[model samples]
Target: MGDSIGFNVFSFFFLFFLTDIAGVSPAIAGTISLIAVLWDAITDPIIGFISDNLRSKYGRRRPMMIVSSVPYAVCTFLSKEIRNLFYPRNCLRI
Candidate 1:
């Protein structure tokens, strides 16, 4: 699905962003990514259930998408621009 693509692309770019530009160690970057994977794994099914059994007028996925649009747009734009705009050394490095 389209939603899944967004996550996959973000993860692909984000790992490089963390390790290369952010100066995080490879180990730390992998751990951070693993944490995200675990969280996604845990939340996806619960959210799916909630959306499936929801009583909203818009129903199911639409309402979630509508609510998530703002954050998603902000994050997507920010992620796309991060590699060019900033590279803070000794800031987030481990």
Candidate 2:
């Protein structure tokens, strides 16, 4: 449920934000989104393969999930910060 909501929010807002505020054309924004979707589709199976093959004391997937959380959070934070800093005109005020 959470994942679904997050994906929906990201997809809807990302396109609008890119085209409306960031001055990207709709076609280009759509192409970029399509590329992202394709990249995600390609990576899912690769990550699943890795997770299935991984051997660790903590288990196959849990350790990877735990270890990846910090970097994921950091990346999310940095992306938002960079956008706010470098694209203040397009940044959402909160």
Candidate 3:
């Protein structure tokens, strides 16, 4: 099982911080998260399938993992940009 307490605390704290402390609207947060979830749902399986089918001297998963590192990091860094676009700058902290 997962760490339920940690997950719950994180979820509560994050939503509270976003909606109350940070002044973000609930609808904006939900919309951005929904889009991110959908994007992950579509991309993750494709990435896993490609990785699993790959045949290389360096190894299948390892190669994909290595290649994906930069893009993943970049995406994480740029996620705020997409999120910021969904909400007014005065209403949220980027």
Residue 82 miss distance in model 2 (angstroms):
3.9
lDDT of 1: 0.80
TM-score for all models, in order of appearance: 0.73, 0.82, 0.56
lDDT of 2 by residue, 34-94 (tens): 9999999999999999999999998999988998999989977875676667765655663
lDDT for model 2, please. Answer: 0.85
The sequence of per-residue lDDT tens digits that candidate 3 reaches over residues 1-94 is: 3748755665556666667865789998777668867998999899888888999999878887788899977875664465566766776553
- For candidate 1, lDDT tens digit of each residue in 1-94? 9869988787778878777867799999999989988999999999989888988778678888898999989987987666456745445442
Once fitted onto the true fold, the runs of candidate 2 whose alpha carbons sit more than 4 angstroms away are: 88-94
Name the lDDT of candidate 3: 0.74
Who wins the lDDT comparison? Answer: 2
Alpha-carbon local distance difference test for all models? 0.80, 0.85, 0.74
Clash count per candidate: 0, 0, 0
